[model samples]
Structure formats: C-alpha cells, structure tokens
Target: MASSSAATRELQKELEGKANDLSKIQKDISKNHQVRKKYTIQLGENELVLKELDLLSEDANVYKLIGPVLVKQDLAEANANVRKRIEYISAELKRLDSTLQDMEEKQNSKKEAIYKLQQRIQSLQAGKAKA
Candidate 1:
C-alpha cells in the first residue's frame, strides 16, 4: 500500500511538471501571435506607402519623418526603402507562421500526454479500490 502511494505521488509530480511546461508553451504561442499581428499591420501600412509613392510624379517632393523633423528624401530612395521593408515583414511573417505551427504541435502532444497520465492515475485508483 505504501509503495502504491509512492507511485501515485510520483505520477502527480510528473503531471504537475508537464502542466507547467504546457502553460509556458501556451504563453509563448500567445506572444508570438501578438508579434505576428504587429508585423502584419506594419506590412499593410508599408504597402500603402509604396502605392502612394508609385502614384507620385517623378519630380514630386518626398519627405521622411525623422523624430520631429520631416527631412527631404529622394522619391526613388523612399520607394526602395518601403519595398525592402515590405519584403522583410513578409519574411518575418513566414518565419512566425512556421514557429506557430511547431508550437501548436508541441502543445497538442503535451495535451495528449496529460490525458494519458490522467487515465493512468484513474486506473491505478480503480485497481486500488478493487484490491
């Protein structure tokens, strides 16, 4: 009976550890989602800027807001910068998507493990009751 109790304690401890790990994984997934959202917003805004730049005449004035100042910038340079920013944001979104998928997979596996462990504990209790 003492041995059985010890085994139950051990299983409970392991379950607690796994639950903590699962919680951390969930938090990480949430953080990644927030960051991805911010990046997506930035990508959209940059695309809009690029469109506006395209509509501008070749000789039209372009200004970049640096801190409190609007510094004059060449139209071509502004266009290039916006395009590059869009590319970078798109790449980062792709990376986040892959990472999110991996995290979700891990989360699902952990859930399965926890479910199995609960079943094991229940069976052990049922056996003890019968004995």
Candidate 2:
C-alpha cells in the first residue's frame, strides 16, 4: 500500500511536469502561427508589388528609397531585386509552415499523453480511497 501511494505521487508529479511542458509548447505554437501569418501577409503584399512592377513601362524611372533619399536605379535591376525578394519570402513562408505543422503534431502527442496520465491518476486515487 505504501508503494502504491508512492507510485501515485510520482505519477502525479510526472503529469504536472508534462502539463507545464504542454503549456509551453502551446505558447510556442501560437507564436509560430502569428509569425506565419505575418509572413503570409508580407507574401501577398510582395506579389502585389511584383504585379505593379510588371505593369510599369520598361523604360520607367525606378528610384529606390534609401533612408530619406531616393537612389536612382535601373528598372531592370529594381525588378530583379523585387523578384529575388519575393522568392526569398516565399521560401521562408514554406519553411515556417513546415515548422508549424511539426509543432502542432508534437502538441497533439503531448495532449494525448497528458490525458492518459490524468486517467491513470484518477484510477489510482479511486483505488487508494476505497482501500
């Protein structure tokens, strides 16, 4: 009976630890989702900028704003820079999405384990009370 009580206490401690871990993981997942959303919004804006750049005449004057000064830049060079930026943003978004998916899976597994531990603790407590 003493051993059973000890085991029950150990299990309860483990469950509490796991619950704390699950909470931290959930917070990380939420932060990642927010970052992903921000990236997604930036991607959309980049795409719109790309379209506007495309619509510009080939010989249109393109000036890049640096600080408070506008630096003259060739239209072709500006377009290329924008294209590369868009590609980079797209790749980052893809990576962030993948990370989010993995985190969610981990979070789900932790939740399931927590649930199982709770059930086990309840069973142990009920048996202890009856005894």
Candidate 3:
C-alpha cells in the first residue's frame, strides 16, 4: 500500500510536469501561427506593390522611406527589394509552418502520456483505497 501511494505521488508529479510542458508548447505554437499569418499578409501586400510597380514606367520616380527620410531610389532597385522581401517572407512562412507541425506533434504526444499517467494514478488510488 505504501509503495502504491508513493508510485501514485510520483506519477502525479510527472503528470504535472508534462502538463506544464504541453501548455508552454501550445503557447509557442500559437505565437508561431500568429507570426506566420503576419508574414503571409506582408507577402501578399508586397506582391501587390510589386505588381503596381511593374505597371509604372521605368523612369517613374520611386522613393523608399527610410527612418524619417524619403530616399530617392531607382524603380528597378525598389522592385528588386520588394521581390526579395516577398521571397523572404514566403520562406519564413514555410519554416514556421513546419516548426508548428513539429510542436503540435510533440504536444499531442505529451497529452497522450499525461492521459496514461492519470489513468495509472487513478487505478493505484483505487487499489490503495480497497486495500
């Protein structure tokens, strides 16, 4: 009976730890998803800007906004920068999505472990009570 009680306590401790880990992982996943959404939106906006820039004449005045300054830049340079930014955002989105998938799988596995531990704890407690 004493051994059973000790085992139950240990399992409870492990359960608590797993639960904490699961919570932290879930929060990280949520944050990653939000960041991915932001990047996706930025990619779309950048693509739209690129399209508009393509429509403009080669000699059209293009100014890039620096910190508190509008720096004059060639249309081609500005277009190149926007295209690069779109590419970067798309890549980041892909990376974040893969990371999120891995985290979710870990979270699910932790949940399953927690469920199993809880069941074992319950059975131990029941046996202890009967004894």
Top of the candidates by lDDT: 1
Q: Write the per-residue lDDT of candidate 3 for residues 18-95, one digit (tens) a residue.
A: 999999999999899889889988988999999999999988999988999999999999999999998899889889
lDDT of each: 0.95, 0.90, 0.92
Query: Which model, 2 or 3, shows the larger lDDT?
Result: 3
lDDT of 2 by residue, 1-131 (tens): 89889999999999999999999989998998898898888889878978988999988988999999999998888889988988998899889889889989988999999999999989998998999
Put the candidates in lDDT order, highest first.
1, 3, 2
The window of 10 residues in a row where model 2 has the poorest summed lDDT is 41-50
Which pairs clash (backbone N, Cα, C closer than 3 Å) in model 2?
A: none
Ranking by TM-score: 3, 1, 2
Q: How well does model 3 score by local distance difference test?
A: 0.92
Positional deviation of 49 in candidate 3, in angstroms?
0.7
Count of backbone clashes for each model? 0, 0, 0
* lDDT of residue 6 for candidate 1: 79
